[model samples]
Target: MRSALMLGSATLCAAISPAAFADDVLDNPFFKDSSTQVMARNFYLNRDFHNNGPNTQSYREEWAQGFIATFTSGFTPGTLGLGIDAIGLYGMKLDSSSDRIGTGLLPSSGRHTPGVDKAEDDYSRVAAAVKLKLSKTVLKYGEMTLNLPVYSTGDSRLLPETTEGFYLSSNEIDNLRIDVAHLTSLSTYAQSGHNAGGMTRADVYGATYNFTPALTGALYASDVEDLWKKKYAGLSWVKPIDDTQAFSADFRFYNQKSTGAERGGDIDSNSFSFKTAYSYGAHKLTLAYQAITGKGGYVFYTDGGNTNYLANYVQYAEFTREDERSWQARYDFNFAGLGVPGLNVFARYLRGDNITLANGSTGQTEWERDLEAAYTVQSGPLKDLTFRVRQATYRNSFSGDLDDVRFITQYPINL
Candidate 1:
């Protein structure tokens, strides 16, 4: 990892051509005018255990404040345009203690060791990226956040994960998009302190196409050093029955195999999921099914935090264990349909069974239920002020029962 980081840093220095600074500094569009935005978020989380005794932490709770600022420059005025992007992230612990930790809102004092109880007060980081654009194609290098099918940084917490790498994207052809990248390292949102060389390395290639206004498809492949090679393909489609109703369908599949000296041991796995939804006016309903079959669970790069792309990736569990099968039913309502323009409600339930663990136990079962309600200020002085509440419950054959809740508020301003 250290060697890879060094090579990445050296490559970035050599990629920026001297032509970028040829134009007059004041006249270049990249520097003359730029756009900026700032976002402030307040978050609180609580989780209570029903069976884990007092010897362990009986409950987990925390409160934190987060701020994110971003700046993006316009391109230079020439056949070859040059630009830059910058990001600043900060997280402050508003309320926490040694006895009540493990919420991931603040970093722990010790590393990954278990049964430790200490949290940091705050953390902050700054990053910048250089970009070049020419004839509908763009190249970028340095630190940035990515949210693709194979690799997505977690942003549900206080701060988002950012990676150091080089990226290439092209949209020169109609209805087609191409992307490729080499990611060396990343700092996760859960890090206690910043370190650029602690993450695994990977190479990714992907393509997407739009067959029609109602249908889209994608294919992507990635290789993680000392880990596994992964391939993913998916499709989504929507049809309008009338002005007041619509139907949509989504399907996704993943295939993985051990690579490079069998890093995670011999691995062969396949996972697939499907979801269908129907909407009428402000009401929506959905149904989904997902399953995994192989000698081991579905594989992903775990050194840096990663999120699954499956439809069954719910609030508590992904239901991607070896030989597991799961299904979901969900409902959502928009209060605007009933005259309240800023309120909404959602609920979902999921169940999984047939989990095969290394211990040779089979037929294990688990289930979870989630509910949420939210509102935003639609007009007046606090136009964009938002508030949300979430509650979830989980029960499994081995881990006991759990309940959790979260409260969140966000405000943003453009500068």
Candidate 2:
């Protein structure tokens, strides 16, 4: 029965594609009304640390390969057009050891690996969605990625994080976009299966307004049942100081409180961050400051997945601390104007002080320094292939000392 259903869905998708692209065919019977495209990506990552602590690993390394396939069909004929989309994700481990088991780069089950007993093996997931479009608004349901500022879906690891939910978005108003979503279930990187009975119900709402070509503002609220409720707002502005120079500024504020089962007790926090950047030709410099107030500092939500990529402000880096103050300085350069079209480099330093840990320790300080370089193929058969190397060193009065190096190569193809 399941096989039959899957086959029927695939057949329907094929039948709808031609009709979806009919409008684009200029009196050509062979022209289809719909369009379909697929994107495939492979990512490799390696991490090694110099020292280990009770809470940290001394040396860890991993290499993972992943493949993602997506297919989309255009809406059928009608005022309320409907379409179907499917996505398939698979990941395989290339290297790792028991000492690096919790790196979140692969899926591990209990004490045994799925395909390999001693060695971690492979995992895969398949998801499908139904989409509807009415005027300038679109509604999507099923497995998807959440990308709101307050509740962003992470994509930091082998596979992008996904949620079982429904999302509605509208761009009916010029320069403004509105988004709202509800998530009911989740699956994490540590597990290959879905949990429909978990404590993972959330409601998210937000709107972004582009006041001008160079200025924008956003506001959002999220109610995460059994976890936390948060309200976030931010604004960003950019202006050209001169023909060859530009300046940008950003501000963000978050207010959060615990809720439901996860809230053993009432806890509240308020956090704010501000950043300014200046660019001259191929070089850019940025400075940022952040502060935390209230009893709690910040709240975090994770699906326990390998995909840890989140908002820039939420990253711990070297300056993240509870009720602590921090600052960062960064520099970046593009080598395109220097004749290396697809090369870029960046370095940043962050420092924080006055940390409050689990123990009643204050006046604790920490810092981090990070460097990264990346390049991509601009043309030829391997065009769009990218390579990156990142190195970071962290030292904290409470968290201990750590150093890490990572290298990744990505090949992205769109069909």
RMSD of every prediction: 10.6, 7.9
Compute each candidate's TM-score over C-alphas.
0.89, 0.85
The most accurate candidate by TM-score is 1
Whole-model lDDT values for every prediction: 0.83, 0.72
Model 1's C-alpha root-mean-square deviation from the true structure amounts to 10.6
Off by over 4 Å in 1: 1-28, 31-33, 53-55, 112-116, 192-198, 261-266, 301-306
Question: Least lDDT summed over 10 consecutive residues: which range in candidate 2?
Answer: 303-312
Model 2: CA > 4 A from native: 1-56, 111-119, 196-199, 263-266, 303-318
